[model samples]
Target: MIQKIPPGPVTMSDWNFVIVEYQGHVVEKFLGYYYELQHIRFSSQVIEYDPQSNTGKTWSGSKYFFLDRPGPLYPLAQIYLAHFSRNEGIRVRLKYQG
Candidate 1:
């Protein structure tokens, strides 16, 4: 019998991965994953994968921050504001969803 590999643990993908740093000190890191599933909001809480359990759980709430600006907005501005208010560096990475 051929052994089968179980599915990988849940992880946020195809969004932005940001590392927050303040005054040369690492504050926190956040991962944002967005997807449209059946026209409903499908967002991951952005958690670290637990290899043993094959699941992901919320790591740190401070790591992720959501913007609630209204009207037209720019991506750069949003990021900049987030940095200034949150006081952290950001690293953006694309997540691959199959």
Candidate 2:
């Protein structure tokens, strides 16, 4: 089934999949929404963001992750695979709902 992103910053239950270049491979990570803030925590790094701005970045271990958080003010990211795609990478198609 498809998931819908709310028309604003995710509350305390929204989730978005993130793709990162880690260890010479593209890894897909699932980030959970908690508190009134938007933060994605990796193994040793935490990407913080302002819901209004919808953007975040963090450097963890030997990898760095930067993303434009999907929400109301911005377009949502379409996850091709919920799991890590080492070959396909992160495939996302933008669709306009009008």
Candidate 3:
């Protein structure tokens, strides 16, 4: 299911919820959290990304895996939001790799 992020500041982490692009559509999946200084194992499901609308369909029961382990998606920022804050997550931008 696509977990809609609330309107506020947020951060990305390993095994955390992520929205990525796939086949010309944006998808939300739970692979691994952001660890170290790069995003690794971007292998998971690619739901559907609709920037114009705020709606989601049922699960498509599909999965995709990317072998690009270029480290964390974003760099550690100097500050972070409360909702976006985590024990392991650092203050950084949320990057979606399709």
Candidate 4:
């Protein structure tokens, strides 16, 4: 389901209620307070979005990884609001079993 995030801060509690479903299956199930957003960076080819072509181009540089965020999991959602604010080209999707 595509959800629109309202303007304002998104608390951890709000993230807990967000169930990331893809292909009619639950992919990311938040674990209340236990779930945390982790960020990482490494040397790699950077991929930038080309709005004109609606495609990505890889450039030489360090790559940054923002993990456990909503934008990557739900790309259709508006990113200017709350947890959907990340505009980075790189992201990591992790399934927490804890």
C-alpha lDDT of all candidate models, in order: 0.33, 0.36, 0.34, 0.27
Positional deviation of residue 25's Cα in model 1 after best superposition, in angstroms: 3.3
lDDT of 4 by residue, 1-98 (tens): 33332222112221122334444554222212211232111112224533343222223332122223322323222232234324343233333211
* Candidate 4 minimal-lDDT segment of 10 residues: 34-43
Give candidate 1's total backbone clashes: 6
Please give, for residues 1-98, the per-residue lDDT of candidate 1 as tens digits.
22232323323333233334445654323333322111111222445533454334444321222332112223443454355454335433223222
> What TM value does model 1 have?
0.27
Give me the runs in candidate 4 sitting further than 4 Å from their true place: 1-5, 13-21, 24-94
Which numbered prediction scores highest in TM-score against the true structure? 1
- Against the true structure, what is each candidate's TM-score? 0.27, 0.24, 0.23, 0.18
Worst 10 residues of 3 by lDDT: 74-83
Question: Which runs of model 1 end up more than 4 angstroms from their true locations?
Answer: 1-11, 36-47, 51-55, 59-98
Q: Write the residue-wise lDDT of candidate 3 on 1-98 in tens digits.
A: 22442222112342333554435666454444333324422334435423344222224432322233322332222122223435353332335432
Q: Give the higher-TM-score candidate: 2 or 3.
A: 2
**Between which residue pairs do clashes occur in model 1?**
14-95, 17-91, 18-91, 19-89, 20-89, 21-89
Candidate 4, residue 15: how far the Cα is off, in Å: 6.0
lDDT of 2 at 42: 23
Please list the residue runs of candidate 2 whose C-alpha ends up more than 4 Å from where it truly belongs after superposition. Answer: 1-12, 35-98
lDDT ranking from best candidate downward: 2, 3, 1, 4
